[model samples]
Target: MQGVTVVDHPLVQHKLTIMRSKDTSTASFRRLLREISLLLCYEVTRNLELTSKVIQTPMQEMEAPTLEGKKLVFASVLRAGNGLLDGMLDLVPAARVAHVGLYRDHDTLEAVEYFFKAPSDLENRLVIVVDPMLATANSAVAAVEKLKSRGATNLRFVCLLAAPEGVERFTKAHPDVPVFTASIDERLNEQGYIVPGLGDAGDRMYGTK
Candidate 1:
């Protein structure tokens, strides 16, 4: 997390600009999030190990590369994380999925986990915990802790956006997990929302607000 992967690629930045505007429609925002998620997924999975194999191409036989193992798991940090899931799944369609839900205590800013589900053998799998935003690191950090306690070892975190404070807190808490985010926004507000964030991800994505 110290070297949190922040994607500043032009396309991602452009779509993020669209997301930030107050007038962006739900359909447009959803499409943009999916498109950007696909791009971001490409970056996040770049280092996955590959094994060589003989295969038949359209023209002729050739050596091909495939994933080294079948130990991948995709864990979402709840409602908003669902938006990022489809895109990541497009890249890793076969990965097993898990979900964790955490809500904040308005006064204390602490995370309260109300729901959690995951693969039983999490310790041996390559877990990718994804969420749309990393704001204050409360839910983010808590989710990782829960995953670890449940036996997740090889873990990677993916997000659409992040705040410096959140990233710092997360890395300090779990240095082993590398983080991937499309953009790192400015500081967090008193309520822990990333400044200039795309409002509430869950609210915006589902038209709850």
Candidate 2:
């Protein structure tokens, strides 16, 4: 659909497998996050506007296409999203980064915001709200809502993996924004975890819980 993209890249699948394994070491998990983020970046920027520019090459002058419009803002959804940010930055080094922290309450399953910071001119730039695991969609939806409230008009959501339930909820909540993920698994478990999905991305990345 227009609002969702399930990336079929082989490398994405390879790294995702590593990330999903329960035995994957913390350092490896961190590395996989970075690699997957870079892969996601390629798909995310595929439709970016491009304009021709004249530039002098080593041999001669040539007209080359360059990205157009305001630079993108990589807005990481706190802890887990931070792991995705560094790799995306490698693809777009000059891009600015914003941080939004939201934690799902274990009891209520509600998204709680502890920190939020973004570019003041977000309305003119494309914003990518990133997190590795989009499970129930509460944190992700809340993050996007908060960004819209802060004058963000152009927006895209990126995550390494997603649950089908999360995808349905997120798309229904904000159909106008596109979401890019490496994989979408089965339904969420009773504890709101993605069934057979990577266990607690936040914990895997940080070695906590």
Candidate 3:
């Protein structure tokens, strides 16, 4: 609640509702995630700093506002995060891309990283880490930690859905990083799944389940 910002735009809400439905087809759900992610990108990047640069617009040379500093980085938390990645890239086409592969260790309920690759200039740019679900916060927290280990300082987290428990834990672990989500669901179920969440995002999107 403290650092979390919900993107409650009408289009986002509409798309999310479609995604949450059990009757939705895999192709339809994937399409909706891509569409909703574009809206979330708008909210998450709303405050990016702008600078003026002289440019000729047709007849006159005038200053034009453009994003300042290095290009942003979209660090997707693998599999499901990739669903948001395509849409986010649609908005910031010049932004760099990174992937962090992590999975929850069922017994220990801890995040285990299998792969990580990022741009070399992560320290100089804003990094927005994305995942579709933040149920237990294990994977999200670990992914952010791995990014920081690679010199990513200016970071933010984005998700399609999040549980209150996950949000609290994520904010407490990294208060400096802000979070953006389309919705905050009631709570997580006993199996560490977000209640009423769009099922396993990866499975649903790719039809694995």
Model 3 clashing residue pairs (backbone)? none
- Over 123-201, each residue of candidate 3 has an lDDT whose tens digit, in order, gives 9999999999999999999999999999999999999999999999999999999999999999998889999887999
Better of 2 and 3 by TM-score: 3
lDDT per model, in order? 0.88, 0.92, 0.94
The residue pairs that clash in candidate 2, if any, are none
State in Å the error of residue 86, model 3.
Answer: 0.2
Q: Which has the greatest lDDT?
A: 3
**TM-score of each predicted structure versus truth:** 0.94, 0.97, 0.98
Sorted by TM-score (best first), the order is 3, 2, 1
Candidate 3: minimum summed lDDT over ten consecutive residues — where?
103-112
TM-score of 3: 0.98
- Assess the local accuracy of residue 35 in candidate 2 as a C-alpha lDDT between 0 and 100: 88
Model 1 residue pairs with clashes: 123-151
Question: In angstroms, how far off is 43's CA in candidate 3?
Answer: 0.4
Please give the distance, in angstroms, between residue 198's alpha carbon in candidate 1 and its true position after superposition: 1.5
Winner of 1 and 2 under TM-score: 2
Task: Report model 2's TM-score to 2 decimal places.
Answer: 0.97
